[model samples]
Target chain A: MSNSTSNTPEKDHKSSYRAEERRTLSSGEEEFFFDVKTSDMEVNMGPQHPATHGVMRVLIRCDGELVTGSQVHLGYLHRCAEKIGENVEWLQYLPYTDRYDYLAAMNNNLGYSMAVEALMPGLEIPRRAVLLRTINVELNRIASHLVAYGTYGLDIGAITPFLYAFREREWIQALFEKICGARLTYSYIRIGGVFNDAPPGWLKEVGHFCDVFEEKWKEYRDLLALNHIFIKRTAHVGVIPKDMAIDFGLTGPMLRGSGVDFDLRRDMPYMAYGEAYEAGAFKVPVGSGEKGELGDSWDRFYVRVEEMMESIKLVRWCLGVIEDGPIIGEIPKVIKVPAGEAYVGIENPRGELGHYVHSDGGKVAVRCRVRGPSFTNIAVVEELMPGTLLADSVAIIGSTDIVIGETDR
Target chain B: MELQAIHDTLKAAGVVGLLGCDEPRPANKKEKDPGRAGMPFLLVDPAEIVPLLTACRDESRLQFDLLIDLTASDPAADGDDLWVLIQLLSLKYRHRLAIKAHLPKSALSIASATAVYRAANWHERECSEMFGITFEGHPDPRKILLPDDWKGFPLRKDYEFPTEYHGISCE
Candidate 1:
């Protein structure tokens, strides 16, 4: 790596001309021309680049083709959601949750709703609303994981699967559009209940989707999971051990991939989760290989695939047993709760989306903080990246399934 | 474990003397015991947090391996004490202990839990940056979410949002 070899004549001419100009200016003084050495190479992966998936700037320090080190610069998309949450009313803030993790808006909605609902004891949300919420949220989870698995393949060399994943995702989005007015940011969930009841034949459409998803899921696995190139790209890369995963406070599939058998829905059931119908239907099955090694990119990928299958099963179950009833719970027009603090954690698509809310016996919450799983997942990148190659870093990041919106929120 | 037994154990350990254990809130909410029998809550000084956590971790009955969540709240409207809440969960006992340390907002200094739990590194960093609380022993204490040159702690009640920093106007 020689700095003196000027590759382009234009750059060399400009450099020499600047040097000559400086020399002419310092003719009357004794000046020392200290040499300034640049690095071996530097690349800006972007605040605008496509592979970054969001407005993230990663400055990569490379020696030849290998990455020496890297620094992640976030906040390009920061909206100060916590501050915004404080300014808005409890119900008004429900719409903003959708923007936090736009990929899985329903999970975000459910997390905030559950936290608020926890404060108000004896608020009975109808069975239909709970079932509707479960179905839509599972659909959103499938859509989110599809984007994760598909874009992950796109992050690597495989481009065809990205379209395939998007095609399936569009179907789910269509169902969401039918239920809610919006597609991506469906703020369908209310504080006590949902915005509205499910439309006519909505359950049938979801049931039809569940019927078709099993076959489509196999196609997804065949396109990427069985592909030798993708396996070579991801396997044994970005392995976060069980202890390290726990120490880093990693959750969701990332923690489960490291063999931690903790799922919030299964471990600590909340909001009609442990009911007899939901117990048999909506359980998330953990993925396992022959040797039972959990901490690998393959395990993470397979877990998301298995989770999608489980989510489909859950949606089918919810549609069959759902009964028509009042969506909103009985409460005063102006909602007020006793002064107390409650922390609620829901299993979002990426990980545990925890909300810690403190109320001062008023309509407004005193303090609310979201414990985003993406934040913890992204923190372990420094631990995972040291020994891996430059290209593999993208795979590791994608496999980690980080949404910078959620992380930087 | 019964609440009285838990209180008795803490009293036996000599932790009750430092913080006055006079009036305990009864486990039964209806019982009006103004000056109760035992300490319902233990108030450990900010400096003694690490040692107390270590003791709790090492104790046979209280093997608190998980530092569940750490948060800072402004309890007083007059901007008095910054209440730091630390929730520790023991996997062995399946019990949770909530420890709160009240410090003046001006001097928001507390010992870091990095040595006890590695997960506390980021949690403490977030708390420190957001609430203007300084975790004394944290290795990398620089701003986590906010920019290095950020003017004020945004989460604090008294924080004023700046229009600009480093000649970049936020407006």
Candidate 2:
């Protein structure tokens, strides 16, 4: 596996000495040279770099330190999950969903399970299954937001918050492992219900974590949000307006940060969000201060923090409501949906993660199209990146919370 | 609000007859008629697309601002014409309209909507590269998601996936 290299001539002593002489040109002559050949300079950000958060290559066209334009190259982590969904059975593809957005595996599981349930309506899942799904998804949401906040901080040169955020996330992953036997890609969620009920003492452990998390939340806010330097780096930067956000088809925190007041879990209320809980039971606090200024990077960061707090509230609510019942519904071993097409969307940690399933009453889905939130959210970069500094682009992209797996899937 | 009212509005704007919208079914299914579901999508003639989309946006009951998704599907094997489906969502009306236009397998040309919606630039480019369709007035119509020197559209039914591109295997 030898790496490929370009065969361009290296800059030896003669070329360097000649290049140095050109730098000392007169001002008038330099202006003439600049006017005559104003070719765009190409700079490759990475196929292997740290700030990208994953294997993504962006070719940035720049005029000095200002980014003129950028072309994002994907397929670095393309596993063809959609094509794989076609090949596998309907029930077996739940595991592959975890790999799409591994940061929020439970949300991925919930989205796929909801799509299947919508296709095969009247599966008769017990109340316990719904509560367990809500708890697992909210826990996943907290873990995902922790990574987004931690990595965003890391991008802006903060190290302590990233370590603290991961320290808390490890505990949540351990809770998931105890229930499903696998940590990250736990395909615990089934078509009509979940794979198994929560183990003994699982609810008690989750309850204790929620109490501990409330204290840790204050510490996080004090450590990072209250810091003057972090605020200066984030506030009023990468401000996404509400109208432009709607125009670009943005959703989730990206939309809520813009003061849209639209959440699928609240607005559409799939799963146990509406039926099993009260209206104000799980309150995810959206940031509110001013009108046009709501969607700035600071608000975007604060929205995630408040969302973590809300998820904790929902987890506690689920732990209280969870009871002993049949976990798996009366679904046949070989599942077959009706011959029709349905588009099912769930409020994933990222945004509106939708699965459009078309079945022919066959063994496998005829076509399964995923409307990835990252793909739509990242498209607004062309609208946002025109007049920003080169360095601020990284901060803006990080704040959007895009995973390349979902973007390129 | 209804498909007929929107169709009448487009007709008043000098569009041709609105082709019947066909709800696609499985290959082996016996049903061939397009009925009125809870939400109905109207298919318009390809030549009248630019005017119809413009009228649909300007009309009071139908202000389809958001182009939800656009893609081309191969229907030649199913004894049907090749069609491009443009799904539009109206935020004001809270409705979805799927406009369909059929062309011969060889010639798949439609008017570009980049002038109407800025977001259609990349979506049209992606469709063009995947289905070998041509958007007549597309600005900077270049290949996206695929290389410039790539041979054929991979998503087309008869198209074959290449083993390598510029010495890098696509696999």
Candidate 3:
């Protein structure tokens, strides 16, 4: 990587033109040899701006069309869910996790439940239940990625992709409703296992949805994933440096987008995902930058698109092995977690959603902290967002696919 | 390569009296009373955190580069002693280790892990505000999930929740 002011010029492409200070131009308008300007426009970009992705305000200072610097204002949606976790019993707090990443509700439930289960000694989840959880979460991943794909398209001014993404999301939601009777905030994944077993046709319906999804996901790829406008808007924009990505604790697509071949499900191996990965049912899709430079906004967006396909393969594998058995574990109805502390990190659509449960020898947890991935993922923008086009801010945030619901929580 | 073996190496390297300086044991297996316990962690002195963390990251054998998570718990016992959880994972070695620092609430501060792990900035800020534990020497120690005007640390075990704020009732 050469030292250049020209868009940090890609590592391989070094330009000889030095961005030096000094010089004058024709006409009355002066042009400095370097691009330094005295004046900067400070714009408040949102707590409500659709592009900021839900109640996140970025105070962006720009020199003409280029953003000079920015400061992010968060906590517009802080409900103190962790404080509430201290008051509620282990099982009672399931709904709270749903709110953290409402887009990937089942994944949230899975992470929290697994954390609590780790506190209990010799607690075993039924084989059928684990399969059911793997399937449910992968489906949720597909659903969440669809929203990412759609909103990313929307951010780049492609409205058709949003509608198409939601078209698939609605179908996934319908399947979830058949299982747990809730579309957005389903508190179905209980601590021991799930709230209930799959309804009679739910498995078959999900299996059928997988078949439809394989073709539809590629249809989505054709719609906006490969569209020229989307590529131009995203490729090479908001390129996250590898060191910054790891230092900021970025996970999920954001880390993978930077060409880091790590996913907790595959590397850490939890639930049935370990078995699935070992059986070659799924592969971790790292960002190779087929459309643009690695770690760029395009790679971030492309990672999510590729992950949905990997999820489809995992779901299909899970559907094939899902057996008939009890869904819930042998947890006490009162749900008293013995005095202990356990932390479990699960791979979510956004990244690693870690749940820290500290029990105080009672029914309720002493302190329950949620390590929301979006919370960490959003921090990188403070460093990467500057020195980019003002319009590309929307592109960067969309590619990051942040749900401020979790970021602010 | 494993966390237990690394601890043995640390002990051999003269890093003792951790978890409890003189008394280190799991919370459930304290021997005063016995029950099933979760993972056991070592307690380090506040001053030793940065150096230990540096060694943990730079040491070729125990290269715990990723600080997976950092949190503090307000146990709310007699002495106002607070517990901080530092979870570490070595991406290259594939092992996990945790260190618990018992910071006396009278001071409520310790060396910031930011010097070792840049990711601790936000986590430290959140810890500072929520549990009232300050990560001393943190570059940006602003409140993360709480407002600037917020009064008390909400996650503190004994902290009271305000029934109202300004002109609005919280209920």
Q: Against the true structure, whose lDDT is highest?
A: 3
Candidate 1 lDDT, tens digit per residue, A258-304? 77676766666666566733458755555353222357677788789
lDDT of 2 by residue, A98-178 (tens): 888888888888888887776665578788898999999999999999999899989988999999999999999999999
Q: By summed lDDT, which 10 consecutive residues of candidate 1 chain A come out lowest? A: A7-16
Alpha-carbon lDDT of model 2: 0.72
Off by over 4 Å in 2: A1-40, A276-278, A287-292, B1-68, B72-104, B157-159, B163-171
Q: TM-score winner between 2 and 3, please give it.
A: 3
Better of 1 and 2 by TM-score: 1
Error of 2 at A210 (Å): 1.5
Query: Which portions of model 3 miss their true places by more than 4 Å?
Result: A1-38, B12-17, B20-32, B77-79
Instruction: TM-score winner between 1 and 3, please give it.
Output: 3
Query: Clashes in model 3: which pairs?
Result: B17-B21, B19-B43
Put down candidate 2 lDDT per residue, B1-171, tens digits, no spaces.
566676776777666758865453323435753221222457778887777777766777678766655666553344345666666656565555767688677567888877766556676887798678899999768865565777986555566667887888769
What's the C-alpha lDDT at position A58 in model 1?
Answer: 75
DockQ category of candidate 1: incorrect
How good is chain A of candidate 2, measured by TM-score? 0.88
lDDT of 3 by residue, B140-169 (tens): 888877879899887777787799998799
* i-RMSD of model 1 (Å, 1 decimal): 6.1
